[model samples]
Target: MIKEQGLSVQHVCQSMSIGPTAVRRWVEQYDSEQAGQPGIGKPLTPEQQRIRQLEQENRQLRGDVEILKKGVGLLCPRAEMSFRLIDELQTKAIPVSQSCRVLGVSRSGFYEAKRRAAAPVVCKASVHLRAAFVASHQSYGSRRMVAELSNRGIAAGRFKVRRLMRQAGLKPVWKRKFIHTTDSKHDLPIAANVLARQFNPAAPNKAYVSDITYVRTGAGWLYLAVVIDLFSRKVVGWAMAPSMPAKLVCDALHMAVQQRRPGEGLIVHSDRGSQYASAQYQAKLASHGFICSMSRKGNCWDNAVAERFFLNLKMERVWQREYANHAEAKIDIAAYIVGFYNSERLHSVLGNLSPSVYERNMAAKKPIVVSEFT
Candidate 1:
């Protein structure tokens, strides 16, 4: 082969492992070639060059097919006959069967696509919606997504949003539940229902709702007691402990006392739970010169403010976590209650302002005595 390209006979024998006879035959072919085009190498005819180009193109196409096959195998490894079927369908121009056979997508998948025709796709529009959804921390479910779409002036229904979420494998990270955390089962003398189902407070610190909730953790269960100011809907004081003893509620009350130092007649309402009704708890309230109020037995509505707070806490935070133990739950709950709930969470009744913001607003307003001394 080398001698045919004008190499010396001995060089061909040594370099190419060609025997003497093969080298002599190649030298003979080279002499014939040089006789035709004297010392120039033989050139390929047009057909041979065309064939070479076609062969190169075929090899490149095969390489691409192998890469595509590998990707499809990785994505849907269990399924067989992916790109091969796609290519066959493409060649035959039978997209429907090709989609079903190659993609291993069922007839139903094709029908679904046909029934729900692929909408006019715009890369920019999809990019915007995906960016918005992602920027929301995936906290938005179909309802919120639909609302967002509407806000962005994009026409979309809840079902459509749900379908898109399914396609994108997205879900809302937050959920809701009915929380029944108040254990009003203490033997202590219950206070009068002074709040009287009146949750509205005309001034900050005038009325507060207290409740206790259980958060599971590694150590055990961490009990959280909170006093929410009714006027501002702000959690003034919160305490977390390993149990729901009187001290749990007492610490929370003390926090409120230290923080607000409301006038000598602030009314603090709670259910007839032992934590609140305990003698020690009542004495603490008296020490702060605060009036104690209790909800009637089994009537959660009487302490609705506290109930609502617990509900929101569970819905927004607790429901989303799997507590490993008491300590972990405490840390997460503390962060949620103090870091997010009290300071950042927007309450609809508070005109969508956080409790801190609402309290600041209330403090800005002049207090008007709506209730008079008897």
Candidate 2:
């Protein structure tokens, strides 16, 4: 009406029931198309509209080609890797459903992969479990493995750890039968079992248990004595020698005394071995004002904590290798006690904390009482 009847834009808008702005825009677009120039929005002429449609189709085709090329490049023998690539592309603004369709992967599989990727614990737990197993000399079962993982800030249950361990083919060393090393058949007087199966002490340095065990080496036997504090199950002192004499037990006691410096009346329990009954060992205890307590004759269970420690030492470290001499055995056993058992090995009795860790935690919870030796 504006072109044929020479109507004003306002008149045309009124007649067409439209706004004046729309009339003005339509006139301008018509003029632009007639003059073979591009205009914004839908074209006013069929030729321009066809060109716009073709351009849109061309862009769509280009996008399709790009998607197909990427899909081909991302194809892999492993579906998991492909899913990971798809995830990366989705983060880069690629459509997940479209990518999955182009890559011939199910959308459900891609979503599952996304869920697994979001929760990294599943993958990380397996890796950390294997490393911890190896680090513990392959002697950590699922229970200890769970504790170790918890220490590392990974929350995992025993069943989960067990499954991961089984998948990794990890098997811990099993414990063997305990060997008796106590010889109480002597005329020396024996102290009463004052401890009387009181394996758990309420406070540090209150009570201690000592025992001696032999390690086999190419150069013969190497004897090891340990003094364990019942409070934390920590090996407060240890000594290794070629013979199990009064000196061996005494040296171990001396180390314990020097480290702990327990007060007078500290109950020092040990098996009724000949060394414990010897005058030298008894006098050493008497000099420190420490009360001696002997385990009953032929009863390993009476001093079971000390015996268990030796059993663990043999099962985890001693039996695993053949030492050439006492020096080699001493070095290795010392490493097991100080480096691993004291600092890293988890004890069920100590609530899955290593002996050193248990002591440190207890000291943190309360003030330690240091004693002056008499």
The prediction achieving the highest lDDT against the true structure is 2
- Candidate 1 differs from the real structure by a C-alpha RMSD in angstroms, to one decimal, of 19.6
Q: Write the per-residue lDDT of candidate 2 for residues 47-124, one digit (tens) a residue.
A: 777786787789899899778767666566678877877878888999988878677788999888777667656658
Off by over 4 Å in 1: 1-187, 364-374
Stretches of candidate 2 off by over 4 Å are 1-116, 175-179
| lDDT, model 1 | 0.72
TM-score of each: 0.54, 0.69
* CA error at residue 32 for candidate 1, angstroms: 89
Error of 2 at 298 (Å): 1.7
Q: Top model by TM-score, which number?
A: 2
In model 1, what is the error at residue 168, expressed in angstroms? Answer: 6.6
lDDT of 1 by residue, 331-370 (tens): 7777877787777655657765668877777666765433
The TM-score, computed over Cα atoms with residue i paired to residue i, of candidate 1 is 0.54
Superposition TM-score, candidate 2 onto the true structure: 0.69
Clashing residue pairs in all predictions, respectively, total: 6, 0
